[model samples]
Target: MITAADYEQLFAHAPCGYLITDEKWLITAANATFLAWTGYTSDDVVGTFLARMMPMGDRLLHTTRSVPQMQLTGTVSEVSLEIVDASGKPRAALLTATRSVNHDGGVEHRVIIFSAHERRRYELELVSARRRAEESEARSVRAEAGLQHLALHDSLTSLPNRAGLALILERGLTGRAPGASIAVLFVDLDHFKSVNDSLGHNAGDELLTVVAQRLSSTLSSAGTVARLAGDEFVVVEHVGSATDATVLAERLLEMVNRPLEIEGLEVVCSASIGIALADDESSEPEKLLRWADIAMYRAKARGRNTWEVHDPSEVDPAVNRMRLLGELRHGIEGGQLRVHYQPRMTIATSVISGVEALVRWEHPTRGLLQPAEFIDLAEESGLIRELGAWVLDAAVQQGAQWSRLGDGNAPVSIAVNLSARQLADPQLACMVQASLTRYGFDPSLLTLEITETALMENPVMARKVLTTLKALGVGLAIDDFGTGYASLTYLKEFPIDELKIDRSFVSGLGTSDGDCAIVSSCIQLAHAVGIRAVAEGVETDYQRSTLLTMGCDLAQGFHYSRPLAPELLEDWITAQPPSVASGRAAGPGPAHAEPDDDVEMLAAV
Candidate 1:
């Protein structure tokens, strides 16, 4: 309904720029809006080519495609192009064009262009934000992966740790086919502490790292190797049999024993391995680890650089021993272990010379158990040190109590046995001194009985410990003397007060002439060295007579009395005849009417 002039005004002042081009694509007319948008006047734009307003790329695109497309369709909508203004400033724009025939029947194009600067800026910002988000997500993923790696791997060696080993073992067991076996090898380095002490911690770490690499490479096809803290590693594998595990362990040992160069020094190392096997899914990860640990200790006991497989048949005894080991801790704290006194008599006088404190475990379910039943287990389980310390304390306290009862005169001395482990402990002398101080007991009143084998194990350390103990005024006796490889030089070197002939030799007294001669020589040797001789296992008058004739100074056996509890010992001591109690030598005659009464009488003396 608008007039021609109003329509023309509307077209000239439109929000978008408008232009009319001829069939040759030259600009025939440009609206005021179009000229203003381009920073151009009608006189400058009219009769110019429309494509000249565009950048070279957009102009080529328009000439090649948009013109042909518009010719077929009569219109092109939303054609994006870049244009340069009259001032040579670039701008993004969207254009729409329509084709029309003028009165002379010539082709002309009407084009509308819109500025898109803010829209382009918004789109670029959106793309930048999306890219930043993707980068942040990637970083988070990498960080999470790093954290997981740190959690499961040893920082020093990059090997999986205990937790990772458990997980691997669990997964391996779970995924194993039925009747297929899963095995774990517990590896422990031997004498690793010596390396640490001799070199330094850094060298030790380097050695461990090299060992770990060797193990990993050796077992690459067979299993996974993991570190279980210092000098301990584990291997998880799916093996066929005990033999397979043993073979693998031997291979690993050979590889490990190969000389390693650490910090320019050639170091040789050895490892002991314990293997545990499971055939089915019912096997527990932790239990398998424990079995491997036990077997590893057994391997260590046999001598290091060896391997042992956990046998199912022997599991009960091993498990029971472990259980007893646990109970032993409770026993020590709960007073289940009692110290029984076995009296040692002066063979010349039949007087109570001293009492050997023997530990007996009054186990709740098993009843009374002797030292022979559990001592080896204790030594193997590392409980011997604790047991030895407890016995030391108890014996010292009892000796003190007896000294209190004796009014400081003729205090009954107590002898306690020490295990090889206890003797090897550097603090043995300190512990002994502490016990003596705690009970206010004279060190001379305490005798520590160590086996000859224990002394011979490391004579240098033994000499040092023995000398320290001797300096504290305590008596040291070598128990079971003839059984070990003790040379006369060793006997002369050690500050020994007594040599107790092993019961094995004394058991054959009077029956075996060779035994008789050995006992005689031991007695003479003891006297020659100015040390007292003690004959153990004297059960008959004939044995006692022979020992006394051989000049043995002390005798202890069932012939005198069995080991007795404290209260019974008190009663037995109170009932002895004064003649025997006053150090009068008893004749080696036939057995008395009441051997128990004789024992009681002997204890009283």
Candidate 2:
């Protein structure tokens, strides 16, 4: 319905700018709006190149671009642009082009242009908003990633933590191909506590970080290195055979055995490496980890700075331990686990003051199992929590039963061992109290033995637990006192009532001057703090005499009697001369035994 006059009016009065260009894209005609958009007059653009209207950067885009059917279609898609305005400032724009063709004259190409100032402004704002949104989203993602890393990494060494290691272990085990074999190596640094104690925690941290870096750097192709926690690092390798695993493990040992320089101090630490091999069928995180840990302990026992591969066919203590853990859980429900009393005699008075309640697993198929056979397994499997509670309940019940029986004048106290895992349990204090109340035994008659290592693991927590136990009037003794990394500085840190000199030192009292010195110092240390010293494994007269001379308060070993059932101990006590039974029962000659008390005690007991 439009005429030429109407078309002309529409072009002139249109809200958007309009323009016409020839085949060469030269500006042949333009409307007032178009002229105003570029801060140019009709005269200025009449014969000017269309390139002149655009910025130099956009001119190249314009020249090389195809302006298809702008005349035929009479409209073009929107395009963004930046052009110089009246003040020579860059103004944002959106451009659309249409084409017109003249038929009367020789075929001439013509194009129409529309200005989009408001549209370009909106687009620019949107771009800016999008950039900000992207930046914020990126920042949020990074923050979440950092939090996840913190949750699964060690703060000290900046290495994967136990949780992270577990994740990797799970992946390594499950992602293996049908025949793919994985080698898991558990590396433990030797004497790391000595470094922490002597050189300070900062130095220890520095050494661990350096060690972590070394462990990472030393990993061969297709291996992953992670710090499981503390001074322990784990290496997982996709290897072919046992020999390959052995080679990698040896290489790792050599790498970690090197001395490290930390804070201008030379710190030397050896490593114990344990390797467990896994195939698709037998691979699992907990199983592999436990086997590797067992192998690592084996390496440590053989001496550090060495590597040991797990022999699946070999009678691994860890397998037995895992079995024991399973058994312990069932034992509680099935009522197969029982408390066996090992009487602790007074050195000055041979009469029993207490009976250490040792845990015995009466396996239906496997005869009676000693604690040595499963205690370490319990510690490793985190089953110590349940085992410790059982011991507490069983010991308390037996103590109360004995109290009712009343050996003549008074009842004997019952002692039990508490693993480090149990001490870390938040419910330990309440559990102990509940056990005591349930058994109706005076809390004073219950003694708990903890090794030096357990006490030092977490001093604050251990101290809190011990304090609670002491407040309940329960006795606390440091078992195997001189065997572990116990510091004298921490002796008074806990409310300790007794110190049992390790039988190792006691057995060597007469033979080794070093052992004698240890025993002497132990006795002095005990007396200095008003805590009585009980020397275990006093089999020979010489060991007993040395302990007596060094002022040991009590002694227990074969020289007295092996840990016996209550009836056997009663019979033994009844048969002995009243003087020997009530007072000190001396052992035979010092020559009749080797001075190494630990071996003798372990053998006899």
Per-candidate Cα lDDT values, in order, are: 0.80, 0.72
Q: What lDDT is reached at residue 596 by model 1?
A: 15
TM-score of 2: 0.65
* Strongest candidate by TM-score: 2
In the range 284-311, model 2's lDDT, one tens digit per residue, is 7887887898889998989777888887
Root-mean-square deviation of each candidate, in angstroms? 12.2, 9.6
* TM-score for each predicted model, relative to the true structure: 0.53, 0.65
At residue 118, candidate 1 shows an lDDT of: 41
Error of 2 at 241 (Å): 8.0
lDDT by residue for model 1 (1-605), tens: 88989978988988778898987778898898778778998888999887787778446645658778887998877777767898998788887889999889999998887778644665687899999999999999999999999999999999999888888888888888888997789999999998997799999999999999999987657489999999999988778887888888999999999997887889999988999998763489898888888889889989999999887567545667778788987887888887777767777667665556678899998898888877877888788898888888887887778777753123356667888998888888899899999999877667788899889888998999999888999778898989887989999999997788999999999789999999999998988887778888889889988988888877888999888887776665556677555442232211211121111111110
In model 1, which runs have C-alpha deviations exceeding 4 angstroms?
1-79, 82-134, 174-180, 220-222, 261-266, 281-284, 316-322, 329-335, 342-356, 365-367, 370-605
Segments of candidate 2 deviating more than 4 angstroms:
1-16, 19-32, 35-111, 114-188, 191-205, 212-251, 274-298, 310-321, 348-353, 407-411, 421-436, 457-467, 483-496, 581-605
